[model samples]
Target: MTGGISRVSYSGMLLLGPGTLPLLALLALPLSWVQVGKLNGDVVVQCDTLEPHISWTLNGEQEPMAELVAEGQNLTILGLDLPATGNYSCWAGPVLLDTTYVVVSSTYEEEMDVTCQAESYHGSFHCSWPGPPSAVFRARLTHSDGSVGLWVPVAGGHGQFSVSLADPSFCPFGEELRPLRLHLEGLSDTSYLSLSRHFFLRDIVRPDPPQELTLRWQGEQLHLAWAPPASWQLPKSYFALLYHLQYELPNGTQVERFVEGVEETQVQVGAQRVRISCRDPYTPPAWSPWSPWQDLNAPQ
Candidate 1:
């Protein structure tokens, strides 16, 4: 009975103290909330100035601006929720200290570009764009002068293209100039590019001159002989040789035929009066003027 009475008196004395009750009530109260800042999206950015009252701008508009209230050296904006298309520039204060460009994601189409190296012959070029798997690609090649050409369709994803050109005259011009045009159609988006200051064609070795020209006698089928031209250069520079032989028939129609690997400069033809023509293998081969019809009737 005495112990219970003592315990109740101690409890009453503890409640009577002014500091104890207030301290306990203070401990029971909830803590104040702390603020945090974060940023999102894949776009990279660099901040110039560090100060209070920092702001953000989307496509150079202040209405969509937001203040960075959090206290930290580095702040990140998470999942940048932007509109269809915009050039996002984040600025701090009135001076527009930091600027950045942002192009909104497109659902319909996208494009990528590549600058080829100098060694690229015939002007190297590359282009890529995101699309559905196994989707076809359509491309159009144009000149800087705004001349449009045919569109070619090719397989999807990154691709390679190359071409060469020559003059119409078929002369030994040594070099030619023209920007090659490769066009593609059947793509998901309508993307076009006019490649300029790029290589369209490259220099290739000149072909060897004609060879193995033969002359013969049509009248007695005798005294067959042949000789090489004096000015013709021997041991041709090119790896291969192209040759041809020509003869005129009785009806005045000319018969001509071409042969490969004809290293020999001269050959013997048949019959009495026959004319033979020879020429170098032009890139697009051409026949030289027919030689004077020889008179095989001369004594051997």
Candidate 2:
């Protein structure tokens, strides 16, 4: 206000000399910012009525600019240089009007280092990366079938983010090992980084154990039926499943059979005990915890 600009106030109106401006407290002003590439960056702060004269500060010190134009009662930083990058505040004889943070960079950035993996088969995964405070982060899921989606956020904001497939149509499993890709990106003040990782859904496919397992006898033949996992969101047509139905004979013989689809399975169920398990025919993932076994009379 002393060596910088002159100001006068009356009837809620502000008056300032040609080279005088407003000085709005940093917190009071809605953080205004401008990002510039190899060319230049301009930051404009508008205040009430009367024309204002303004100067800028870099970080917190005085920084010179090329042009100070009046497009209203506003101050414009029209400089295309690296030194123009910093926190700028305007002053009209010590009455703060507004503040802005100017970012001057070529906008050429490097890909950030990102890594991700499927921690579970229930369509949830985690991706993490270490980035600077001036960076913006985002996550993506690249399905093996070449489909892309903005991954659903789970927890851990900032540098670490978890994602899940909210849409059931985008099945996480297939007839073949699904190389679901995870992509992490970071856009920084002056640069950017992109990172990606691939995972086989089968490796992490741990479906909830099969449900509603039932075994009964229809005269001489045994009838065994079970429903798909309750947690599976997709319809039967969307993905293929492999069921492992097994039984033990009275003499201690263990026999196993594989079934496709959830259509009630009826087999010559003649054994001392019977149990069931299932997997994705594609990831053919590890067998879910075995289902409870049922004891029944041996086939005559």
Model 2 segments more than 4 A misplaced: 1-138, 142-162, 166-180, 185-194, 199-207, 231-240, 249-253, 265-273, 282-289, 292-300
Q: Any idea what lDDT model 1 has?
A: 0.35
Where is model 1 poorest over a 10-residue stretch in terms of lDDT? 4-13
Error of 2 at 253 (Å): 4.3
Predicted structure 2, TM vs. truth: 0.39
What are the TM-scores, per candidate, against the unseen true structure?
Answer: 0.26, 0.39
- Cα error, residue 62 of model 1, in Å, equals 2.4
- lDDT tens digits by residue: candidate 1, 132-191: 332234455554234564444433443433222222222222344454444432211111
lDDT score for residue 263 of model 2: 43
Write candidate 2's Cα lDDT for 74-155 as tens digits. Answer: 6565644545444456666656555544443432334444444342344555455555544544566776567787544333
lDDT of each: 0.35, 0.53
In candidate 2, where is summed lDDT lowest over 10 consecutive residues?
8-17
